[model samples]
Target: MEIQLKLYGSSKILSEKETLDIQLPNNSDIKKLRDILTKIISEKYSRSDLENLPKTAAFFSEKDEVIDDSYKLSNKEYISIIPPIGGG
Candidate 1:
């Protein structure tokens, strides 16, 4: 199943890309998605960098409403992960 992913904030810096089209096994869960993303980010940034990223990660449905990360996503679903904004 193919899914749309959008990364923001420091996560974007780590990914070196704002968005991506990832294909995961059918019925993949949030945990699986997290693992996949972690690996992708780790490839660019150190594991410590990813781990230090704010915990403001979130998942939204097609309607743009906030949904639990564990919420099931369907094929072609669009997921946007907006990390917390930091300032001086």
Candidate 2:
């Protein structure tokens, strides 16, 4: 299965495109996605600012609703990654 991750905020660092395609096994959940992201970062962008993104970011469905770590992902689904925001 593949997920089209629409990049937002700091997540944009993951790729040069507006969206990043992530391949996963069938029936994989958001938790698995996070694990995969961690590996990607460690392997490719170890010193980049995305190190904590997988653990702190929030995911949204095509309908723009929040989805948790246990949410099941379907093939070719368009999801959005919302990186955490900091404020004064």
| Alpha carbon deviation, residue 1, candidate 2 (Å) | 1.1
- Candidate closest to the true structure, highest lDDT: 2
lDDT of each: 0.71, 0.93
lDDT of 2 by residue, 9-84 (tens): 9988889999999999999999999999999999999675788899999999999999998999999999999899
- Output the number of the TM-score-best candidate: 2
- Estimate the overall C-alpha local distance difference test score of candidate 1: 0.71
Query: CA lDDT of 6 in candidate 1?
Result: 81
TM-score of each: 0.71, 0.93
lDDT of 2: 0.93
Instruction: Give the least accurate 10-residue stretch of model 2, judged by summed lDDT.
Output: 44-53
C-alpha lDDT (0 to 100) for residue 59 of candidate 1: 63
